[model samples]
Target: MRVENLHCSKRINPLVNFLIVALILSPSLTIILIPISFLLIMVYNVIRFKLLEPSVTRDTHEKFLQFIGGEPYYMDLDTYGKKGGTYADAVAIDAHNLYVLHEDNAVEIPWSMVRSWTIQAPGADRVVGVGMTAAMTAASHNIEAAAKAHEASGLFVFVADVNHPKWQFRTADTTILRKWNEILTQRNEGLLAA
Candidate 1:
């Protein structure tokens, strides 16, 4: 399947984004920085794209079969979640359970155990966002482009077991976002294994 992968991580390399912001704020410097910035940005995005690329491994899939005892329909490793810094690979769901694989361990969470999944901005604090049209129109200096690029990128905090309410996985992958929307919606909740 085609992976949109890091919609935010691979968008514009941080340095290029910095340069763009710097130029936008100080337009006169573009006369000297423009050509150099363009070349640097092209190079940076290529390199960062390669480095930030996330993949699901053969071992991960094999292990899923062994432990979860089901064929994994989705898996990813450029994924990360924090239960106070625990998993790096995440949000894998099979027929009976959702598997969250940590750097050193894995948890098989039954579908029935899941209490809820919440979407929120990067930091613990949430910002009420403007609509796409308003966000774009207000971006006089394309500042909104930077903000909007990250609009869809946020942490998905889920409680796999209500008893362990303190236990949470905050996944920040674009694939996880899309998959959660598709597989865990109200319309699809009835389809989950009991």
Candidate 2:
């Protein structure tokens, strides 16, 4: 079963049409209007995704559950895509495997093939200065630290699969990271027992 979470065509068509009409009707204004229109679109998307469309995540989760035929041991519904877009991507763990669900495809990796996993806070390694005074350096360091603290965290998994060795999923909510750590600990303990 294939699940498509992105409706890019539906969203893009109207925007494209609007741009075309603007160019035809007022070519002189097109240059000015284009940037304004794009800025408005960006703001609208931020509002829609961050506030209005949380249901999209739930809906994607439901569809994935249907595809997998049961509840997963662990699942994160809110995850960013590979290129930092939100296409309702998800990461899940069943009894025997880990699953990465993208908009068009799904990858299943056996539990035995998961070499390791870590929760990585984004922007943690960002460098603040090339050459600056101590005061400036300290201030930059503080700002960078603050930014890192607020940035989305990601789950990075190292797998043995040749084709797809690494999988990463980013989420703004830190609770998801904690839950994933717990699940991984339990799974690891089970594996050691067996």
Candidate 3:
């Protein structure tokens, strides 16, 4: 798929632009107009995102199918953190290779080249608390740490390639990460046995 076809341009609401112009001319109504402007922008953004989601998903699936001919054993569209001007990203597993669709291109990594894979939770040092009893502090810190980990967990795939040794796909949904990890482990074990 051509990368140029995936570029999307979002047009700002003309009413919002008009409202901003009004606010600039009528400075007396700044207090009332500011909140209304903010709310309208928020609503517009939510609606726009909801409408675009399905098309984005469909395009990602089509891209995957075009790139990987056979039916994928496992496919996930929620993967992220690949940043080479790609519109969407997904990870798929087949019998012989692991496929990553990103940057409007598909990359196939043979099972043998996958050295290791793991679901890495965010570090505990991300959250810090202050001015409490040691036990309370510890408890709060642990709770915050767990929450952060759950929110920012990612799957790390270590490949044998020298230039691109590690691939990280970040997602808040740990279930998918765990599932990928299990599938990869099984594939590695099977490769070893063969």
Candidate 4:
């Protein structure tokens, strides 16, 4: 389809609309259009930066990690039509043992819904030399470090708290997934116990 036809009818270029409105208003002695035009431009720029631009940086993922409170995660391409906006992919949590999140939407992972995700780096070098063994070792170490207080019982239960405000719920192993399911089941049973 043509570029002009790519957008929905409800959407139109802000600059074009602003110019048209300003021209029409100025002739009718409506100086308010000047400020309106400026406001529209500012809003357009903000939307462009936050929702449209997809340029990746060395710190893109890092920034996202900080947004989610520095948690480990995996990437998933999100092409879910209008909800995905302009980008073709997204970085999602590895809810499963595999690096893949399994479902296209993060909400489908039996946890809370995902607000948004983005890749920090779009460079090829990021994944080139990264070996799975090294990655797993580092992951295990991070888990151990993060789970220090909980490891005292010999059973390290990694729970995916999908409802947590900062991060999406995910674990490094399927055992944790099962454990979480069981925990939820038991908690639900308690509710039904009454």
Candidate 5:
């Protein structure tokens, strides 16, 4: 399929958009706040790196397990897209559905709605590896630290369906997409018993 022909639309993260709007509406306060926030961020990064371990990626599943319950599922970083920018949005997946939580609303999509899917990873991801346990598994064999670092890199997930328009989402890494596909697509046509 002609991906080059497809538009690489920019994804404006909604929370960022809201904050920008709020700041614009209050320019006097924004000017004052921006400098303070920048200083704080710079200080935090400096001190955190010097004195503390870097933060780990929160397991997207465990974070929202209260909202979704099932064994052995896939929870992508909630960034949905096969290409383009990937933001760390609140996205989760279970055995039979994909759950996306937004600022004012949530979306739950059945597996039936996903007719097909594709994963888009950059050259870097392929060099490190791009799926499931294998990615992590590869990490330990001399490339452990490098692979782990690569694991948090960006990738996109695309879903195509007859009933709905084609959609794309971003993921923090390719493993999320692979794991999601493995769990969500294991069973073919039968309805998930829920």
Candidate 6:
């Protein structure tokens, strides 16, 4: 006599089943998942870092740095030619305000007080800035974006001094961003790996 079939289909985990369903329903789920995963990893890493290296990032002041966002950053009156000068202990954001804390102050800047930033000397002395006027001036002077003038249209600087123009800043395309997402993805992986 012939034997009857007895094998059953393999079981799948409910957790995985839900994920499949959701992914199928919304392809964008993958996009959302990546950042969320990275954020979670970052949070975990930060917590781990705090535990492992307390001195490296003690409080927000020691760990936090000021960097600008966006592309084609402007050079302004407050931040122009602030480089090649002394470093500043107190970084002035505008005419009335200054940021000197290795930590953030409780008082929030109202945006009106902002003026510009500065750069400092190599030994971390002196001060300078990249003001709006400076950016406009740079642009107007060359008939090109400041980024192109210094071959830095992709980046912006924030000076450590009002007189000097070495302001703190970030670039639209840092060395890592040149290759686009591939570079960034690799960078993110590297950061996580570190």
RMSD in angstroms, candidate 5? Answer: 13.8
lDDT of 2 at 184: 84
Worst 10 residues of 6 by lDDT: 1-10
Q: Please write out the lDDT profile of model 1 over residues 21-118, one tens digit for every residue.
A: 57646757644465555446446544554544442333444554566556676555443321122123445676666665544346676666666665
lDDT (10s digit) by residue, model 4, range 80-194:
1122222222233333221121111122222233223211211111222246555544544553454442222111222354443232222333344444444434433553221
RMSD of 4: 20.4
lDDT for each residue of candidate 6 in 99-123, tens digit (9 for 90 to 100): 2221122121222333432222221
Instruction: Report per-prediction Cα RMSD to one decimal.
Output: 10.0, 8.2, 8.5, 20.4, 13.8, 26.4
Q: What lDDT does each candidate get?
A: 0.47, 0.61, 0.61, 0.33, 0.43, 0.29
Q: Better model by TM-score, 2 or 6?
A: 2
- lDDT-better candidate, 1 vs 5: 1
Give the TM-score comparing model 3 with the true structure, all chains together.
0.62
Better of 1 and 2 by TM-score: 2
Runs with alpha carbons beyond 4 Å of true place in candidate 2: 1-14, 17-39, 47-55, 79-86, 123-153, 191-194
Inter-residue clash pairs, candidate 3: none
Give the poorly placed runs of model 4, Cα more than 4 Å off: 1-13, 17-52, 56-62, 77-91, 94-194
TM-score of each: 0.42, 0.60, 0.62, 0.21, 0.37, 0.17
In angstroms, give how far residue 6 of model 3 lies from its true place.
Answer: 8.0
Backbone clashes, each candidate: 0, 0, 0, 3, 13, 56
- Candidate 3's clash total is 0
Top candidate by TM-score? 3
Q: For model 5, how does the per-residue alpha-carbon lDDT over 1-194 read when each residue is reduced to its tens digit?
A: 11111121224356654565565466577545754544453454345333321111233334344455554344544422212222234455566676653321234567566556555544332235466445444443434343344444332234454443444444446676676555445544444343
Instruction: Report clash pairs, candidate 2.
Output: none
Residue 11 lDDT (model 3): 38
Score residue 42 of candidate 4 by CA lDDT. Answer: 48
